[model samples]
Target: MKMKLAATAIAAACALPLQASADGEVNIYSYRQAYLLEPLLNAFQEETGIETNVVFAKKGLAERLEREGRNSPADLVMTVDISRINELVERDLVEGIENDTLQNNIPQNLRHPDGKWFALTTRGRLIYASKERVEEGEITTYEQLADEKWDDRICTRSGKHPYNIALFSSMIAHHGEEATEEWLEGLKDNLARKPQGGDRDQIKAIHAGECDIAIGNSYYYGNMLNDENQREAAESVRLVFPNADGRGTHINISGIALTKSAPNRDNAIRLMEFLSEPKAQQIYAEANTEYPANPSVKPSGMVAEWGEINPDDLSLQEIAENRSAAVKMVDRVDYDN
Candidate 1:
């Protein structure tokens, strides 16, 4: 996706392309940037004739919703990370939406038990290892990241970031905090350097010979292949879906929810149902370089080439419950230092 908005243009416009509509409409407050979602939203409008309005921001949509209360124009909230979705639910900002289409389209583990939110796309947290130095079968599970055999060889971003927090939360969900704390300390001991930079930086570190292995989300690999500067660096590493033999690889989602005071409730439901269908899922996931939430819908482009993901079955809610504990563990180990 080539989105070339100048910084001034983006700062002034904020939300782009579509303007807020008066009728037969649904308004979206998205943490997902407009460039990443416009193609899919345009498709939704063309198919359903429902006018869609979006306000995209990097942060504070949740606070805005709370401030607006019943007067809010938001019909749906779409964003990355399960914690953000759960945060909306925790604040009573969104309503439970259980329908035949949503239930049938999303798997049981991905949707909330109360039906307040549903996952639209997923990305696996995988090990990206140097193809030349790291043998294919050298690592098989997330537990192995902490092993002394891999000492001073792993690279990753800050442990407190939501992506890593969610992953560590899953570890706490699967293993008690005591065991998780120990594993976290061990993993810290094995880091190639104090955890630093984003997922792309970890891959770049591998390419630059700073480390033999790095941890990153699945889509970054697909994205790297699209960039001329990062292509060779991306190719130097092989994607590994860890824990395939046991609990399965850790995974995260970008999801959607309906606001509690949606002015366009029926139209929003129509849009939600439409988005949950296989056709829309295919378009949406491919555009975002994500695994479609619907099991029957396959990922497209180079993402498909990464091979299939066997995601862990643990409830995302369980992971959310353990998130605070996970963050505390990270600080206790001083992983980011």
Candidate 2:
């Protein structure tokens, strides 16, 4: 799998160059892997007369755009995580656009304050507890992962990974760095083994009885259930939307922004607006097993069965602002050690 992914990435990079958008065309530089974008792109092209062109890369599109300057062909950038999109804003690679469609479809908290980036779908950083061992209500908040009762029982990936960094950033947004530092230390103490593996491995750990609980994104539940080898392991655990009853779950997005030097600004804006509409959002969210940013669009059947999520009201603006401080706290606590 790793070899195939690396090969695919190399091929993608070899194929990518600054594309010049011609009339009625929009060029996209996306961090999202090709599989996730292909279907949506096809639908988008079919729906509108505008031609769609994409270059997929795992990383470094921002630097490429920077090097290309005003000559860059990218009309828009699509990527996951607030920090990644925020980097474009920080580096002046993307620009804010005032769009009534975005304003209507996306909530204020799920968008850039300056209208630079807008969330397309949301996923929660949630708890996965053993179905046999953890009772309903046994854990209620992200803070509970710190309790000593779970000592030597919890599991996670590296604290420095962007997903965890985003989660930690949210902590800073809510409780400040001092408290977040303490929380990280406690959370670390609960680890059953050294922090390691992707989110699905944590579910496999629960199935293997390596631990009674783990931390992961919500979408993995659907993915694991669909994989024949992972189905049983996925079934052995249940999800907890931590803090759902309080501040609501800590959620993040896969989002997009208009490039600063869009050659086809009008077509790019039209694409953005199309994506915000219910039909496109339905395809985008369902295929990814995520909640659409548009409230009117429902999640897939499997996702809906997991239960509704009430996302935290705290601004992603504040959360993105606190990311650097969050990473520092992880180091201070030696969280992955």
What's the CA RMSD for each of the models? 3.1, 3.3
lDDT of 1 by residue, 3-108 (tens): 2221123234343433233577788888877678777777777887877777777677788789778878788898899888888988999999779989999998
Task: Give per-residue CA lDDT, model 2, range 1-337, as digits (tens).
Answer: 0101111353555465645768767888788876787677778878776777777787888887888899988898998888898889889888988888899999999999889999999999999999998998999899988999999999898999888999999998889888888888999999999999999999999999999999999888888888899999999999999998888999989999999899999989998998988999999888888899999898877889988998997888789888889888888888888
Q: Look at candidate 1 and tell me the lDDT of residue 152.
A: 88
Which window of 10 residues has the lowest lDDT sum in candidate 2?
1-10
- TM-score computed on alpha carbons, candidate 2: 0.95
In order, the Cα lDDT scores of the candidates are 0.85, 0.86
Residue pairs in candidate 2 whose N, alpha carbon or C atoms collide under 3 angstroms: none
TM-score of each: 0.93, 0.95
Say what the RMSD of model 2 is. 3.3
Best by lDDT: 2
